[model samples]
Target: MKKLSFSLLAMLGFFAIVFVSCKDDDNGDPAPLTPTIASITPSSGPVGTSVTIAGTNFGDSPSVSFGTTSATVASGSTATSITTTVPAGLSAGDVNVTVTAGGETSAASTFEVTEGTAPDVTTVVDTVVALEDLSSLETAVVAAGLDDDLAGDGPFTIFAPNNEAFDSLIANLDVADLTAVVAALGGANALAGVLQAHVVADSLPADLIAAQDYPTLNAASTITITVEGDNVFANGAQVIGEQIIADNGVIHVIDSVINVEAPAVDPGEPNVVRVVASPDGLGAAETNWTADNTYILDGFIFVNDGQTLNIEAGTIIKGRPGQAARASALIVAAGGTINATGTAADPIIFTGEADDLNGSVPDDANALWGGVIILGNAPTNNNDVGGVKSVEGVPTEEGRGQYGGTDATENSGTFTYVSIRHGGSLIGANNEINGLTLGGVGSGTTINNVEIWSNLDDGIELFGGTVNVSNLVVSYSGDDGIDIDEGYTGNIQKAVVWHTGSTIISTDPRGMELDGGDGPNETAMPFTTPNLANITLFYDDVDGSNLTDAFVMRDNYGGSLYNSIAFNHDAPIDLERLTTLGESSYDRYTAGDIVISGNILFNINGVTDAANFADLFEISNEGDAALETEVETALAAANMVVDPGFGTGATKFTPTADAVTDLDSDDDGTDDELPEGVQNLGYKGAVDPAATEPYFANWTKTWAVISQ
Candidate 1:
């Protein structure tokens, strides 16, 4: 009996030991991170090009997967990132992009298939070559023997006027088509001479012309400039908008058409441009010397890098697309000063630098140009991954957006009662600028009480600067209202944008795009997070297009959004392609890495479905994060409104009937305060906000931008 009992005990002990072993085995191994490929640049490119992939878990990528295609890493073992050539048979359009690493297969991103090249069709060229029976403009081109010239070799810059602009002229000038007009004047060469007069032989960008009087293709004629408003004029013609950028040449559209006339001045006067940017209030240190002629600047005008200009209140500065600076145009760098102080009675006013193109008057087409650009001493991050000598399109060694110069007190100047109007547009191929670009600006730069009207691009694009801007009122911008790129570790608050476009938008992974164009991928790129709050972004344009958004975080990182409202983005809350493009692993994060809270969102567009964008949200926001979405929805319902009061007379930023945010920063002129949980006011550099400041007056005014 004793022996039997001992046997039973031994068996029990063995069973207990087995159970403990099983438990240990279950818990020993850590849960592996499932990574995925998020995106690849060029959207679609030929197979031979070296593509950049952005994703998460790239730290664990042993290999990457594209549909059934797989490629081994030639270098950069990061799981969240990989490079591979496209296999021959892949169809056009986006394909399932995926990556495998850490013994795991990640979610896939959409990779577009390669087309031969960009669409090369134009109204002018198509008419001349194809000889389309349609389009009067095309017919006119055919009549003019310039058809062969337009198709000729050397690149040219043509100032094209639309049919309407030309039609307006037809009533005054008797001509059927361009061929008849040229023939009446003389012949093809006579027309060519006229064309040459309008054409700038070299790539004389708007910025270049803003500096001095430039002579065009015509040997004798010179276009003198008086930048009262930030307007660009070509012999008194208002150059509207449009860049028909072809490989051979480029075209800038003009309104009211073009007519060669006598120069404004026979021998342009002594060229003494009196910039009366100062206001009425002048101290003993300041002399109020009266000048016969004055060029009043609506916003802060930044000429060269190392120049300074002062301003005062009640300065009836003109906002020109030509000389007059754009609204909220700050010369924040290159050491300039804009002492613009205004009072309630006579507040500093900035008006658009547009001309009356109606035959009622003769106006320069390049009248209203763009805002100022202060070329500061800073680095730009634009490099290829393989330590290649240079990037194809971007400026080599532009360094990546950076700060920290020798003169910490490098004053970009102050803007108290300044307003810029109608600014920002394309500068080059992927090389345009924004409304108020703080190019490599430092923190010491003073920016306050600034307003921007109708800008072609983002109202303000921070290019790796350290300038804190507050009380910003952006009206209708073609793209994002405010964009921080290249480590723009600045503070921006008390901003309100009510437009059919993006609010605080981000592109490429960096709400702050990395200085270097390419990093190991999204995770490897260094970026700075800014601070924001007390804002309202009213985005109506949906369809995943960038016309509107409270914010769109692309390939970038960092920042906290508190007490803001985002409404009717038209599509999903996030436009970030819901997958990491590189590799997946524990070390690197996927592309859609963001922290969103305390904001409201409204969906005017239909709700998402099971197998589509809704599915992506399901995968990304897994684990039932309904509360966050609920908050977003609530905020949008409360704050979002249609018709941002852009009526004929009373348009843009016209305060709605019941908007509390409009009064948010009104009383506290210099310093306003946020509620308790609304701590950090702006993009603080790893610091918390102590208090808030009042928003600038008229936060909801429609400033003119570069549309027409």
Candidate 2:
């Protein structure tokens, strides 16, 4: 009887549990559909307006209705978002919107559907339509078969050649039937490419080209822009018409046609000496040039006042490194044009050793030497000078300059692209010269785009000259990269110097070096101070590192450096007077005159103070906020380049035996030069751990230090 009663109780408990469970399963209350309405760009979206909805919880396939009218749902993956093109017959009124997701719909939301406006076409963008104005461009394009390519979906940049440009291209062509230009292009396929040649992908407004470089789509080709006295030209073709509206692209009418260089067959080799001097006379020496950032010639170079001796781009002139004529490669008389332009890739190079061969070892190939010089209206601090004078406001020895004519306007020569590498050879080690030694370089001299890389001595040691240069790169010099003792008032911008040794290791500040106390006398440069703007440097101090406080602005060193940066140095910044000046008015020049602001100085050598650090800025401004601000700004712009792109750590030495000598050192030395049983070939500077360690440093001098 008791068991029966327990069973009845259990059955009743089970029924109660089932009822409770059923009630729990019945979640009739739907999840609170949180509604969020993000704004659509245009409240009154046009009938065909492709609008984006910005909101939350718009579940996929949510039905968005325009009032009572059912609109075709476009995209609905969120409860708070839905996109539907405006249906026809919509008026200005608040339309109800609801989002439905997972068999559930959200509460009605409000959206404004206003009367739509007509679609308007703003400015049209064009693709690849060459200006119809170019006289001979059409002919060349048809010949090249670029017409169709221009008509295609592309914005090409074509270095269109004018009538004269066409003449220049076809002058040597043996094909007689010039009328078949289009036919010879292999049909419309070629036409498209031909026309495409006249178009740059980006529509370059004619005004943006100001002695600048622009990239083009053509393979290994770029549009050469020349702005001569406001006359703009592409590929030497005048822009007759511009901004022609078209569906494809803009059309700027030009006067000429551009031509691509054809491959030339080489003539048999003859005398290498004649080839150096009379390069163009023999054949196109443009191929396989021997030098860098410089040109060589066996021909007579003529220069007249106002006239220039402009060595065109990529011209190389070899200086006999082993042979007898290794001393001087090019000698520019006082006047004439010297427009030696060299690009970083193909700098006009002038070297002594063979192009691909290694530099002469020791007393032999020391930068088989040659250099470039331009005489202008400037002063000189030749060896015979009495005392070092400030180069400020001092019209340097303009002797033999202004060769073109009396008018400075006519005086023209440019050295936009040039690199004189391995030029400064040792007449003797102590009395070695510089790479680009300006004797009387004047203001008229076009001295930009000049570089001196891997010189045995200082990169650019100016004797006396007034030359303005921007974008000059000086790297890996045995001596200082630039040593301007004598007067040189030239503006330098975007100059990058990567020195492994002393960037400016002056022997004597009394030499009138601006780095120490370059002033008129005691007054510095009377009233004028030379300027150095946008100067940046990264130095790698190898053996026998000369201490440089970035720049040691001394007594008469007056200049303006804007937005400059210094990195990886023993001492990053210094502004102080190195020598005591005379009682003359030249003494008036103080370190305060230098307007240094918007600069950055970052010391990556891990030195905090001058005492702890081998060197840092030693001068102070007595809490001057202006000076401090300049100093701080300079610091911010500067940083260290940890990886010099060279392999890290020790470099390999030259020995083929089973030796366990280390191929590295703290000072970047190789194992080959280690003192084994072999005679002391001495320390060879391996600046880069990757490439065969170059003999960059005066290895003998460093070896002496190591030996001690």
Candidate 3:
């Protein structure tokens, strides 16, 4: 019996061991649960308030914290819900609430600590000091001893540069910090002058500021406020942060410091000559503007019939700031000529009076003067008396401003290596002059290597002309970069358009705004078909700004877009078919009249399918089988990825050899193939990547305003 009992005990022990081993193998201690806070009741409260936190996977004995302070977890807390009391001595501000359970912590959500009462009125100084980003600026203001003036009740508009702006300034000056900045300013008086330059006596909102230049506390200096698209800029500095409101004034946070200094004038150069003309206009004998002198147009200056206006290279011409009747412009009449052929080394410049002949002009200084207008005797769509039509920006009584004729190859004289800036003055409601107005300029004219910067209107407007333009750069124009209207049949090649967001007044800024004609006659004779090639458009994606399409074709406009690279634009190509205006761009493409090939688009918004624009191509001339194959092949080739190596310097658009080879091989449709002067360089975009010679090296290297 004892032996049997011992054997039974051994068997029982063996069974017990097996059970323990199985339990250990199948499962260890329960895995720790991660706490989650799905919802916090009330979201905000004072200290010691009962708050219910609900979520999942909450283990027992969960601890809660409001910001850094620990909270008391109440009893009856479940895995999905917990009740906790807010910690004491918590400050009134935004605090993150987090929960921890079973050695794991959950993510946090913000909880506001409410004061529940009206706070004291804050001054501008107080607001600046309160912001962490403006701490450096606050210290500078205190050092300048202008804190009392800023804190006073009198309203002021202060352009406050943030800490980053100060840091950049310090770096630019080769200094360490704010202390170094103050020391570099020489003394407290010099520092005060610099600070006062940012402050205006009146409280000006964005709209008011954009209207006109405001006098600042700095003597004999003014701050030019500009609005580009949805953004507001003071001088050249962009306003980065929201406007801070205070009891006495408002503060606009900028990304750069505003330094007001008189533009240094050359001692040898003659004093500025104010060309205030009479009602009949200045005679042709006194029309010679030399490079040794600076010419300022106070009113309308016209080059009348049988006259030539000879301007030397490196000549600086300025126009007085005005609008409507007081607007000033240089007009070359129909029979008149302007021999303004500037070299690549010394280009002639037309700018506003505010431009101090210094190389730099604030990008925001626009619409402060009128632009250049050159009228030629070229055929146009809409012809009035004697095959002519009144120009848009000029007055109706100004008969010399009319442009049109039967001549298709009339020369309006030479306009090369010219920089037109701060133009597009408004003469009437919705009527502003373009930067370079070529009204019926014929084929014989030489228009090359021209740069238009910060014009309040279109960069270059061609009205029913056959003038081919090459090596053009248009940047920050208020309207379209290159606008072709009234049946213009020109060839534009090697053009670079940097349309930064929208313009100051006009919201619809495009790389190319092509229109056939303003008419019931949509299919005008020329059809406004310009053979455009090797164009690069860079569109800035500004938040809350109006849509700036790379290309906007409307009103039966049919154009050829070849070997182009459009990057980072909302809509790389936008086609509008106004039924009232008749046939559309798609219609032209379907008819094999509009050629679009070897084009690449990168980072374009809202492009999903690879075959998005495939409908515009003629897939086959024969059967369904051929159509399917051609469609697939063309779509794949057109949408292929090719990176144009964009850099920060003058050679920004130098592409790789592979990218160039891939982009250059598009020769189909139309007998012209390439434009008259453009060479088939076997590369895409404006620059030839494989060439030993640099593209636009001669023209845009140092002379162009945008290059500077």
Candidate 4:
């Protein structure tokens, strides 16, 4: 019994020893020793400098920190030695070095940060490759085969998005990874354009940046930079992190990806609420046209004398198709008034019934309906019986169409921020309606920020009116952008006349057709002495289909042009010496009554050579050497035949900084200085280069959807 008890005790002791050994194996060695830093090689250095941390018990994947900022662990590190580069955003000062491993952190060590010289960077491509967060950008650069171009010696500014940006973009697109995002972005060619949109061809440092649109490598795109307080945004994406400096360029980290598609603009729905506008007599009570409904004109609608038509902003007025006296139009008779004031956010639109405002109609669609006509009791050179004349485009017997009286300051109404599209119809032979016809309109009538596009006839025709206009944009007009006749003596400032190289009507298209008066009374009084300043006339005849001149000054036109620009036209100026009574504009030019100076003309007839200046004026009397010399001398003194440095594609009409500076500093005043009461806030064109928001932008259909 004693032997058995001794054996049981031995067995129990053996089992206990086995259990202890198994437990020790499961615990697995001792917890790793706390990491330690013996010394740091070259303890002081700048950011991005290679740093070696020599210490004890540093595990394979130990993390490192300089003060509170984290440093990226470089490759080829050992258990006892760790390599890292000094992190960015660190100030020049002393920072504590720390090593953390196996859930243990080492005591802090001192590291002195000193400002160092900029790194000797290679190409932007190389710089991108060196950044871990920019791996996605590097991948795209390689995939797009733009690596070679970017690697070359270049002054490139790259707006790079980090991996997290790409991740966010991928998630937004409902895609899995970068590859999927690329595929979803319309494959390689489209992705290439999108990627190029982030890069500018020129080097732009942070200090040189401003609140403006920066042209990108993608010709059609511009990175619009908006600075709010201390934050800078590119295409609504916040620029994050420090700007990475490179040899040939800079790299700005953006938080979000730029959209690959064109900026989506909601043009509002078409045909909301339908209502028929009365053809005549709006009564003494004010007729309010609201935006929540669409007003339709079945025939020539008339706002009779002493009546008022108030159109709300964003109101849509559609005219039905007809001809002759039955044409659909809105005629504000003499002594009538229309208060059509619209904001930039909500412009009053006038179109034909067929127009859906969805860009479905062809750009050249015109003559679909008659246009808006305002007749006032203001003086005209062609006044007949009782010092009045029947307005054209209206029936001769229509007593309400008679315009002209002794009053030069008659108040017709206010028309601001209004867009007239798809109008101008042939109501009579050689008498097509204009987009906005001001027949004997007085100086008291306020017309500003008006856009007339796709009109069959002139965009805005002023017939013996003293009504001054500002901020006018006339695009794709079938006839002249602005046609002045019957001795119009008013001021037109800051106007943009763009002809897209296509003619919707057979009539000659010109930037401005200035005529003193109609035939038989061509040289009648007032002399069409309109003062125009800061006008930009552009003809985009990429297909070489247009051959019209920019300005056709004829019929004894005696006007002054100052601080204007004309580009891509066959000829800048044309003077008619019609060998007929009172039809010689050259006579007016020689008399110093017609001044065309301080203007910029570029690429006339597709050539930048100043020799083209010889062809600048197309006059009927080519043999008149004295007249030619006088005109040449006047133009050569103040005009430039060099490139105006316009932006490309969507911003094709926008001027560059140098162009604006050159024009703004122009002191050419005396002869062609703007008359008093006209603001000479000159930038030499319709759109001000230094303006944060363009006058012709956002609201105009051409700027919002058509041009894009």
> Which candidate number maximizes lDDT?
4
Identify the superior model by lDDT, candidate 1 or candidate 3: 3
**Full candidate order by TM-score, most accurate first:** 4, 3, 1, 2
- Per-model TM against the reference: 0.47, 0.40, 0.59, 0.59
The lDDT of model 1 is 0.41
Clashing pairs in 3: none
Shift in Å, residue 97, candidate 3? 52
Cα RMSDs, all models: 20.3, 28.4, 14.8, 29.3
lDDT of 4 by residue, 570-594 (tens): 7547777755473478888877888
RMSD, candidate 1, Å: 20.3
User: What lDDT does each candidate get?
Assistant: 0.41, 0.41, 0.63, 0.69
lDDT, candidate 1, 603-682, per-residue tens? 43343221222311221212235633443443343233232222223222222222223322233432233332244333
Q: What does candidate 2's lDDT look like per residue over 1-708, in tens digits?
A: 999999999999999999998898796675755545556545654345555455666665555555545567664444555666665433344556555555555566566654432112112121333323343455545544545544333332222222212211222122223234333323333332223333332334332221111112243345555444423444443332232211111122322223332222123323233334432222331233333333333222224343434454556565543111113445444544555665644455555433432322221123445455544445533323342232211112423322211122222356666656555433322444456665446666667666676555566665445566665666655556556544445555555555654333333211112442233433423222455654545566566665454554444445455444555565435444333444211222233445554333445345533233323344432234454455544433332212222222222111111111221322366323222212212211112223353222222212122233
Error of 2 at 689 (Å): 26
TM-score of 4: 0.59
Q: Model 4: residues >4 Å from true position, as ranges?
A: 1-280, 383-387, 578-583, 621-623, 664-672
For candidate 2, the per-residue lDDT at 603 reads 56
The true-versus-predicted C-alpha distance at residue 468 of model 2, in Å, is 1.4
lDDT of 3: 0.63
